[model samples]
Target: MTPPMRLRRRVRFVFELARAVWWLTRIELGLRRNDLPALCAKLGIECDLRSAAPPATEYVVLPRRTRTTVLACAYAVARWPMGSTCLRRCLVLGRLLRSLEPVLRIGVRRDGELSVHSWLEIGGRTLDATSANYATLGSP
Candidate 1:
């Protein structure tokens, strides 16, 4: 068996990764682009008080995206809610995602009448919204 010290290190690494995942998941729940940099900075500080290096800097610089594509295609048979609220939620979640995965790009745009959307993507994979050529709106 590995030494206790090595085992402890392994466990700690796993724990930190898990913590990162949890924080990102929460962002995926609800957050705004402007609200993310500070929120993620706070989260990183709390999660790793021992480290002097800051983590939030990376998230603050990522780009943004806007999309109104459908969500949960597999659940199409289940008929899920695809309303403005859902798209808005994705936008909020995109903010959190910024901090979690620095590589994931983001953008925001508005559609017809009072409609705004945000989304995340990496290597052409749609993380939040569906694949639809929604009308190109504006950005922030």
Candidate 2:
């Protein structure tokens, strides 16, 4: 059987998915960088909140690639106010992004109300440059 610590690590990783979804939904929603990054910052915090206890040892819990959790955490901080609509979308899209890393883009209809917007990219440019239309601020 997996050790207790290993079990905690695995569980933490699963919830990490939830944290990622929440943040990504916010980012894809086009909520400004500072606010969104703030949310993403909470991914680790939120992950711990979701857990019964932290691991016996540091697990180095992280996504497979660079700044994945950071981006996700930033997203959560920015869009947590949007509630479950954004969250639901985040889960779906975050899963897609995980598989399509460096090549994922998820955009939504952007109305004046706080909305969710997502786009995928590689290196620096957009993998799919489609506009989420959260506001008229950004061109599709």
Candidate 3:
């Protein structure tokens, strides 16, 4: 790539990184304040609160390239402050693909130690690195 093109790409990446950081912070704050409903409302997204878990096989996934882009952006931007990548990345990816109607899922396992995880699923397919590790707690 030409020097100017490389510079432009770098600038675009930085801007996107900043936007992802802002969304991550915003989502974290919303959760901390117990204000996710309000946050989603503000973002013009309808929150689907369900007490039932759906079958994991019930989704028509987007194209492979789209999924790759979403995951790449999530990992690239949410790699910091390690150990909490799932939720933040989910939120970031959800915001990025709001039109896809990302389904946010929380899963818990308590055999040895109680652990909870959050992830976003699009078209029924989970969109996180650890998607297979957890059972969905409710509809996502």
Better of 1 and 2 by TM-score: 1
Each model's lDDT: 0.36, 0.41, 0.63
Q: Compute the lDDT of residue 80 as modeled in candidate 3.
A: 58
- TM-score ranking of the models: 3, 1, 2
> What root-mean-square deviation over C-alphas does model 3 reach?
4.0
Candidate 1 local lDDT, 1-140, one digit each (tens): 89998897666555544543454445545355436445545434211222222122211322432111112221221232333343333333433344444222223334555543334443334554432333223211
Residue ranges of candidate 3 with Cα displaced over 4 Å: 1-8, 44-49, 54-83
**Cα lDDT of model 2 by residue, 95-114, tens digit:** 43454333222333535656
Candidate 2 local distance difference test against the native? 0.41
Candidate 3 residue lDDT tens string, 30-99? 7677665566665444444454664244344666535544645665655656345565666667776788
Q: After superposition, how far is residue 21 of candidate 3 from its true place, in Å?
A: 1.5
Better of 1 and 3 by lDDT: 3
Q: For candidate 1, what is the TM-score?
A: 0.28
The residue pairs in collision within model 3 are: none
TM per prediction: 0.28, 0.26, 0.67
In candidate 2, stretches whose alpha carbon ends up further than 4 angstroms from where it belongs are 31-140
lDDT of 2 at 122: 37
